[model samples]
Target: MSYIETTMKKLQRSSPGQPEFYQATEEILQSLRPLIDKHPQYLQQNIIERMVEPERQIMFRVVWHDDEGKVHVNKGYRVQFSSTLGPYKGGIRFHPSVNASTIKFLGFEQIFKNALTGLSLGGGKGGSDFDPKNRSEQEIMRFCQAFMTELHRHIGATVDVPAGDIGVGKREIGYMFGQYKRLNGNFEGVLTGKGLNWGGSLVRSEATGYGLVYFTENMLQAHDDSLDGKRCLVSGAGNVAIHTIEKLYQLGALPVSCSDSTGTLYHEKGIDLILVRELKEQRRSSLIDYLESHSDAKFTPIDQYPKDGHAVWRIKADAAFPCATQNELTLADAKALSENGINCIVEGANMPCTADAQAHIIATGMHYGPAKAANAGGVATSQLEMAQNASMIQWSFTEVDKRLQEIMKDIYQRCSETAIEFHQPCNLAFGANIAGFRKVADAMLEQGLV
Candidate 1:
């Protein structure tokens, strides 16, 4: 058998039927196919299989009292995937879409993303299927407290530090942190996305989105290009999307599209970040609000984004940043992008692109980066927040932001160098996979099959 097929067969043999974890590993492995011939050591150890599987998977039932005086039970999970380099560090997402498969995929990706940060953090992730979409504040608080009541036992500051994801924002984090404090009776940096009034960092909210832009900037520079005068499309209206829009504006790029779960709004001029922040944060309104405010913009239903019920890749642009959930883009979308002449894509959300879409991006010879490497700014800043909490000090926005830039640059260098070393130039997925995989694998080797 060929080396690639053999390696994949070995991984399947070792790990068994784990579709999500397998998908995460296959992308990295495909990129690293060339490495098998030179460094047979990687194949000998079945590193792909070893790293694809989590160290531990915790699934529990979170029973809570709703504001209506009724008890509701929801399934919760915390996938502590790896701790090879350091403690398990990742975010806790709370959305109805979360499941075992979803968490497994996220946790597996976290291992490499954390390693790419150049920090002493391993990879892990946790969350639940309890959707906080329209829940009352008190309802969310009770849920968070109940979730933490059980979760506090499995995590700690130096063990597993989870920040915020999808529906787990500052409010959710505050409730969880308070519950942890009440249960444990000790104050520590168990959570990374805490309020600044407590122990949060200055740029924590902006880190992921801004960090995405930073990575894109570096990629563009390598191509002898820049973000200046580039028209772009960004999905999602959350923190990452908003901050990414702000950063895009700051760097003179026009972000023309943004969306919520309900719909997508596109303005030929550009999206107004201030209005978007207000709509999402204050009113919790949809993208239609922007169109209502400005006559120049157009609002379309979510599924109708491409006008023919196809993906929106046909929309011409210099860059595409998918900041929404996973598998948002399909193979048709990738083909549309290829036909339309897209320049590059950088994921702001974890696994935002399908395997086919990713292949299309690479097949076009466009600059592409995976979420683990491209969207690592948040975790890098989370580690910084941990340091601040440990030292009992806070840093200015400028100070934290400077450090964030340096970390992103360093991550870029890691991916770039690893790709070049393996004679696979510009293949960031391979570089990131190998660079991150080697670090954790070595650590696991040192710790010995536990």
Candidate 2:
């Protein structure tokens, strides 16, 4: 068997029943075939083998009390995938769907994402099956405290720093940081995505969304096009999706849709940022609530979605941003988007597109931005937060935003140039994997076998 096939078979055998992890591994390894062929030293040194396995895997149980004095327990995980480049860096998610496989997939993707940022950071991912939705503030705080009680031992400022993801937002980060401070008795940068009043850097919350747009803009510029006056479709109503819409408006693009687990909200005229923030961020409500105020807007439930594709992708638009969860954009969804005239697709979520979906999009000649390169802005900003904390200084929003834009531009250039070097011009997914892998692989080689 070939080296890539051999590695994938071993991974599948070792991590059985982890479809997400398997998919992520296959996607990255398949893309690295070109690099492996060019550099036989990597094979001789068994670099790919070591890179596939995480440096550490942590699993723990968290117990907390609800407002009614009921005891609750949940499973938590932390996969420190790699630290060859720098400290273990990623996010801590709190959601019902979080599992070891999910965390592994996220951590693996993070390795490449952090590398593309051109920053001294590594890759890691941690989370729990604890759902923050519908929980009282007191319950959420108690859960955060309990989760941190265990997670604090595995993470540190310079060793392994984690930020926020999905259900773990500013509120979740604040609670966890408070607990860590009380337990460890030191206020270090053990975590990113903190509240602005604390060590959190400015524009950190909007970094991922804004960065997605910046990368997309760069791609358009390279193709002699622009986001100006473009009709866009954005999935997910969370931080990434909201910020993506915000940046799209700033660039004069009309974003027409945002969704939640329940359904998608489509506004033909363009989404209302104020109402969306009030419903999602403030009230913690669903997109269906959005229609209560704007009767003109349409809400399509997941059950009512098309048999073969997602409702969001079926919407005719110039661009589509899959800011939702993994495997959200299926091959059928890709076909639907192509049929609907989507000219560009930039992933705002990790592994949002399935392999077949991504291939289909690329085969159709659409400009595609993979998650690792396109969504590095969030982690890049998280590293910036660490820098601000280490220096005991906070930068203005404009300053942080300027740095984020520059970082995204640099990442785009790196991906574009690497693609050309590989003779696969414009194949960003392939370019990203190669560029990110080479840096970390070289670092590992110089460090010697661990």
Candidate 3:
């Protein structure tokens, strides 16, 4: 067996029951055969073995009380996965799905995703099983305060910084920042995704979605195609999907569908962005609420979805963007997309596609943008926010967006060029994994064993 295979088997044995972490590790290791052949020094140094392990793992208890005076307790975690490149940087996801395996998988993915940005940021991820949905503002504030009480000790501007993910957003960041400031008695860039009046960067909210579209545009342009006049289907109505639809409209693509946890909403003419934002962002309601205003749109609940696939993927479209949760697009969903004639697929969410589904899509010769490369925009802009905070200079929206565009373009070029160099042209998933792994592996080798 090869060095990568041997190390992967060992990882699976050691980290048993962590299917998500194992899945991510296997995907990257499988794509790294060429790198292993080219650099025996990496194997000699045991880089793969060390790289699979985190530098530190922190778990704590978060206790808070709701407005009704009911006390609650939840587990919190922060996995400082790697610091080969720079300070540990990633987002803190707040949802019931948060766990050791979930955090480890996300931290592991962030290591490569941050590397692909060509930015000076390492990898880490943290969160709790605290679901923010349906929680009152006061309850959320109490939870954030308690969560930051412990997190504040482990993070700083130049040490380890966290932004937001899933259920964590501007409100959560604000509450956490307030607590951090109270504990430290100082204002600093300890976290990104802050309110603009404080230290957040412009376009930070729109970065991931816009970057996904930007990367897709680059991919299409490379193939003599464009997003103009393309029919697109997007899943999730969160910040990522919302901005993705906005950018699609800007690029002359018609986004016809968006979904939430409850169901998928399909509008044949085009998605009403204003209504979607109102339903999701402002009201924190389901897609079913969207139909209250626009009765012409169709809403298919989760139970009504096809037996083998999601309703979003069942809809015919020129491109598909899965911006929901991990492993959302199954192999059956990929077949449905291919049969429905999806020309390209880009992931706005981390690891939204299953390995089998990803392979099936690639085998069909569709343009596929892996999450590590496509979703790096959000973290890239977060780093930009850190830069602004350090300098005490807030840039305008146009300036920050221009820089984001340049960075996305540069990342796309690097992935494309690396794929060609490695004789895996147009195989972006393989190219991204190889490209990201090489940089971190070389850095680890130079720094020696920790």
* Candidate 2 Cα RMSD (Å): 0.8
CA RMSD (A), model 1: 2.1
lDDT of 1: 0.86
Q: Once model 3 is optimally superposed onto the true structure by TM-score, how far is the C-alpha of residue 189 displaced, in angstroms?
A: 0.4
Tens-digit lDDT string for candidate 2 (1-450): 988898989988888889999899888888888788898889999999999899999999999999999999999999999999899999998899999899999999999999999999999999999999889999999999999999898888999999999899999999999999999999999999998888899999999999999999999999999999999999999999999999999999999999999999999999998999999888888889988888999999999998876889888999999998999999999998888888899999999998899999988889999999999999999999999999999999999999999999999999999999999999999899999999999998999998
TM-score of each predicted structure versus truth: 0.95, 0.99, 0.99
Error of 1 at 286 (Å): 1.2
* Model 3 agreement with the true structure over 1-450: per-residue lDDT tens digits: 877778878888887889899899899988988888987887788888888999989999999999999999999999999999999999999999898889999999999999999999999999999999989999999999999998899999988999999999999999999999999998999999999999999999999999999999999999999999999999999999999999999999999999999999999999999989998888888899888888999999999988867889999999999999899999999999999999899999999999899999999999999999998999999999999999999999999999999988888888998899999899999889988999999998888877
lDDT of 2 at 12: 87
User: For candidate 1, lDDT tens digit of each residue in 185-221?
Assistant: 9899999999999999999999999999999999889
lDDT of each: 0.86, 0.94, 0.93
Extract clashing residue pairs from model 3: none
TM-score of 2: 0.99
